[model samples]
Target chain A: MTQESAARRFVVAAIALAAAAAALVGLTLLAGASPIDALHALAEGSVGSRAALGETLARATALVLTAIAASLAFRAGVLNIGLEGQFLAGAVAAAAVGPLLSGAPFVARAGLLVASALAGALWVLPAAYLEARRGVPEVLSTILLNLIAAAAVSGLVRGALQDPRGDYPQSRALPDAVRLAPLVSGSRATAAIVAAIALALLVTLVVEATPLGLKLRATGLAPAAARAIGLPGARLRLLAFSASGALAGLAGGLEVLAVTGRLYDPFSAGAGYTGIAAALLGGSHPLAAAASAMLFAALGAGSSAMQRDTGVPGALATIVPGVLVLTVLAARARLTQKRA
Target chain B: MSGFFAIALLLAAPLLLAATGELLLERAGSIQIGLEGTMLIGAFTAFAAARSGAGPHAALLAAACAGLLAGAAFAAFAVAGRADPILVGTAWNLVAAGGTAFSYRLLAGATGSVLEVKALPPFAFGLPAAALAAFFVPAVLEVFLTRTRPGLALVAAGDNPLALEATGGSVVAVRTAASVAAGALGALGGALLVLTVSPTFVEGVTAGRGFLALALVVFARWKPLRLVPGALLVGGATALQYRLQAGGGTGIPYAVFLALPGLLALFALAAARGRGGAPKALGTPAP
Candidate 1:
């Protein structure tokens, strides 16, 4: 990238940060809280103490995994809006399978989690096939699929997977052995963050070093040229789609086993959309995507703290991300226009 | 019976109005994904206006203006600035959803219950009135699209902007106008929802109907003429699902029924085998 482009990106990032801060202020006022106090509480909640830092890291882990998933597909020119659905599918699948293997050892339980990831990847194959073979637009198809997935999962939880002890529509918690181990003592922050970071590095290496990665990026830049060079564009897209789904699935599985400890209706909480913003803000680079995810994670975790401490409604966090995405998209448009 | 037809007419009115506007916008080579947001803004504005002592017509007009401004602002970003229209539309939705809720809390003071607003009194021309409006509205829109001079220019802009530009028509102006009109019509749909269906404003009240209208436009292949049947088919399907749910039929999940329209569109396109040709320059910007 040229210095001009780098400078432009920095400007865009700065604008997004400023918009988020403004939104926070607006929301604080709307919620009848002091914006200054809310900001202080947000800062103190996110990084002021060790426990807060751990919570931030734990949230970042899930956000980063989903962000990486979104980054991979977006870099390859596919807009997989169904990541949220795929993430839910992965969580539900893991929740279903993890308890069934309670008699198995820890390694076996971990293997089941990996299998859940693959299951999530497999779930996206239909949409991928439709896009690659049938020329159906993935955006619309995936969005429709998301609605279907929500209803289907909700029904399953209500009908069969309902916990016997409670009427709440959710699956039973996973076995203790299947749960992810925490990285630090006295914190819920798990080894999943470490795994996500390693995966981000692996993604950076694959996209930069591997032949498949080169083909993927080539297809993303110019599909016609990639086709001319005999690059099997459809196959590559399918792989990217599945890999993206798998990463999203991994995030879901981690959330279920590590954070929520069970699968339930509305499992997503808009993580999929947040991941899209993270990937876009990060310019689809894996490491940058991780960093953006951390930013979002901090906002989410701190927003709750702000609400608790300063009486700001927690909706500010939700509102800020959408505004940030809009600002980033507009900035990107400006950049594209400048380049043209 | 008149009752069945009346109910059908009421159901079809909003869809027809919204789809008519969408048809115009799509014909100008710009799809507004923020129809839902535009409608929400309209609904909220209309309700607020009505609550603040404005007459029904005045409230409706205010809604239209709000929709027009919202649409124009979105077009400024997506069309003039060349942002991705989809993302811009989604942003509008996010803003509409959160903004409306925030504003509602501010105005209504967080009662944590459904709030009611005065509904527009329907213009009752008696027995023949509903039928006449339903048929006449779409018929007039169709004629305006195909027979008007600016309509031809708008279609030209969407179909082949370079050719139209060669002929000395401004594609951007036509598209912007169509976008504004589309926003107004979408807002009208929202106002109609408040007036006819629920008689109040609620969050996410449009309930994906705007998107369904978008799908209908594509299903109609940008033909205002074909849209009548397309709208009826969609409306009929929606009515059927509601009827089934009302009758307490549980064999098929309601979600499956809800997804039927999108699934049907995909299948129809697949069955058509890529032959339902879109405008040549649709979704491409004109220089």
Candidate 2:
């Protein structure tokens, strides 16, 4: 990249950080807390200790997975709003299968997790096929599918999948064999962080080294031109979308077998939406998206610390991402104008 | 019997208003997915104003103003800056969601399940208890969209921006205005929900109705004239769900019922087979 483009990227990042800080301050004032104290608390909570850092990394791992999923679809010109649905579906599937194979070996359980995520991708195939064949906008279809998935999951959890011992809408906990081993003994952080990093590396290698990635990027930039060059545009888009869904599903599966240990209502908690912002901020680069996801994970993990230390409400965390997105969007607009 | 219709009509009012407004915007070639957030802001603003002793009219005006401001802000991104419309719109929704929740906690001290506010009183016409306001509001919007020169210009801008530009009209200005109008109508929809429903503010009060409105725009094929029945269909579906759930039909999942309208809309669109008549440049940014 040129120095000017690099500087512009920095400017955009700075603006996003500034906007997030302002939003935190606004939220603090709204909640009758001192913004300075909240900032300090947030800093101390996220990175002050090794344990806090581990927790942040753990959350970032799942977020990075979702972000990668979003980046893939975005790079193929498909807007997969159904990531949220796919994520939930994958989580539920993993949660369902994890306990069933309590006697299975570790390798088998791992395979089951991957298989469950693939099933989640299958859940979105109908919608993707509809969009590819009928020209139904994926945006609308995916969103509607998300609602259906949410409702479906909610029903299953409330009814048949409900933990027999409890009345709450949650699934039975998975067996120890199915759970992802923790990376650090003292923290909730798991092997998923390492897995995510490896996946990010794999993504970078594929995007930079492979011909398929080239085709995908070409189609994203200009579908008409790509089609003119004899590329299978529709099939490529469908593959990208399915792969995106599978990645999102994998994130969900990891959360189930690694973090949460069971399925529950509001299982993903808008992780899919946050993933979109992460992908945008990352500019669809795997490593950058991973870093952005880590930033968001830090913000989310630190919000609780801010609340406890400075009496700021947790809502500030939610506001920060939105503020970041708007600032990034504005800066991107300015950068594009300069380029033009 | 009329009471059932009244309740259904009351429930349908916000959807009708918002969908009509969105219909106009889509007709002008700007698709706004931020209606949920815009409506939320409007609801909160209307609630705040009413709680602070503003009359119903003042609260409604405040809601419109809030919607206009939010819409204009979005326009600044999508129109002036030429940012991706979907990204900007989603950001607006997130902003509205987080901002409103934070404000709610601050203003209400975070205690109550529902934040109570004064609701707008229904204006009854002299015709045996059919409220005139419902019919009057839609009629007025229809006239504004079809009869006015600027309204026709807005549609033209969406339909053929280059042609409109050749005739000395600015596409951006028309789109921005349409967006603002859509926002106002979306906010009015939220305000009506507060007025007619429970006279209280609740989280997710709009509850994806704004999305349903967008679907209505597609189903109506971007015509104000067609949006009337489109709103009814959606509202009827929603009303049917509530009615079914209330009647204790627990065998079939309520979520399945909830999915019916959207699935049905998708089917209808598919059946139409590109004949549903979308704007020529519905998703593209204008030059």
Candidate 3:
């Protein structure tokens, strides 16, 4: 927390940014495009116009929520890597329930969102039980759960949750009456982003200012010491894990109501994993993680535009965050070694 | 029944190869959860090699080389650099996935046509030579881990690094070497897939097989030879799923078939109980 340390951290961030930028430039050149043009395209696509900004904000909604979810679990000493699966579970819940409700738009929307959150929480039960009872690492179990969820989604779209009126392998679409409306004319931005931001702030307040937050951090920081002091580490972990899942689930539900409108195979574009990367980049601080998520959303939005404008591939959006994270990790390790 | 067994063995070959390599790496005390990325790198390398006029065997060699570099790069960051392996791996997957997709676009252009590559020729029992050799990997690993001096040294590095250090060993060196070898094997597993069953490359051609291989290692309780049965079980399930799908209809939900392998792995994890014979120094940085 000292000024010197803060300055050192700034230097590390600068180096990492530089490294990522260098990688971006190299990739752009490899794609036979000028780096300047790519950069220009990226900027214009992400924030140059109202539509681009709207796209960025819309994407940020889910990323922000999932980042908070990842931060919550990580800070509570739980490695809940099933956010991807949990997200899918939430989306499925929304799709399954959204079509069944009628008459009142508000009630139907609320019902769908609640169902999604519950589904997300329920999805993690098996991993939690296996870890608590059988001493299986939640890491492996949660990853396996992700695979299962994906497989289930692929199946549901074709079989159980398929749209009866359509020939495609996808669930019934949510009626427009119940879906989220754009916040402004001619842009895709919706209330989902506002809700995501509010939730991020709330999580920050709970984790930083509350007694529960202190206990969660204490357990994560030192499980043995916390246990010796009767801190109920297991209960805290379970609470954190479930709450995290709920947040991710809510994100998924919002995505259905705000953007996609229906569930299908490959519903997520790795939103959960990218969210985890954002949390890591932010050092697991809820607000910082939200900011990182927004940045990633912008990168994703702009990369597609860049691809359209230039010949460069939009996969750069995925690669850049990874490069940044790896650089940060290596820098942190080097700093720790130096201090040692 | 014989046809089913043959298909199951064919499907098991890639999983067995990847799992064997992973077992060796974990035994040497470092874990690369990014084996999925390594496999992708290998798969892409083979695809590119084949597209650029290399023979199937040469493409395999190229992929193995790419795997070596991927392994070394991972070790540089996670091992020698002393970074958190898990975080490194999480990011590694993104980079590999994105990098391969980016490169594939460059190679294939904006064309939406399917690009096919030459498959490895079948040897015995309608299996490619590489696929047949995959079955022998676990046995070789079993002997290497139990009967050899270096193998014992690797175990020492995993279980008791300080003791190994006292006896003039370097944990970093052993882990790095194991990582490189593991990378080559994992890549070969991926290349074998493209060269045998799926003779064309696509985005994510391995389709979570890398992760399934990781589960297989856990199912095997970190024992090399035990990986065979675990891989076979998952492979058999996949074979069945394919057969069921080909038949056009089934009494059971097809989703159940898709999820069968993961479901089985979860049961295996829960049933096995407690750390399940994981290496003592697993996931720990070299002292």
Judging by DockQ against the true structure, name the best candidate.
Answer: 3
Q: How well does model 3 score by local distance difference test?
A: 0.90
Per-residue lDDT of candidate 1, residues B129-160 (tens digit): 32235446567777776889887888898888
* lDDT tens readout by residue for model 3, A1-340: 0112667668777988899899989999999999999999999999999999999999999999999999999888888878999999899999999999898899999999999899999988999998899888888888888889889888889888999998898999999999999999989999999999999999999988899998998888899999999999999999999999999999999999999999998899989889988988887889888999999999999999999999899999999999998998888888888888
DockQ of candidate 3, scored on C-alphas against the true complex (2 decimals): 0.81
lDDT of 3 by residue, B133-165 (tens): 999999999899899999999999889999999
- Report residue B254 deviation for candidate 3 (angstroms): 2.0
For candidate 2, give the docking quality class from DockQ.
medium
Candidate 3 lDDT for residue B275: 83
Instruction: List the DockQ of the predictions in order.
Output: 0.36, 0.51, 0.81
Per-residue lDDT tens digits of candidate 1, residues A178-207? Answer: 777777787768877888889988987787
Candidate 2 chain A, which ten residues in sequence have the lowest lDDT sum? A1-10
lDDT of 2 by residue, A193-267 (tens): 888878878876776569998898888879999999999998898888888888888888888877888888767
Clashes of 3: 0
Task: Give the winner by lDDT: 1 or 2.
Answer: 2
Ranked by TM-score, top first: 3, 2, 1
DockQ-based ranking? 3, 2, 1
lDDT for each of the candidates? 0.74, 0.76, 0.90
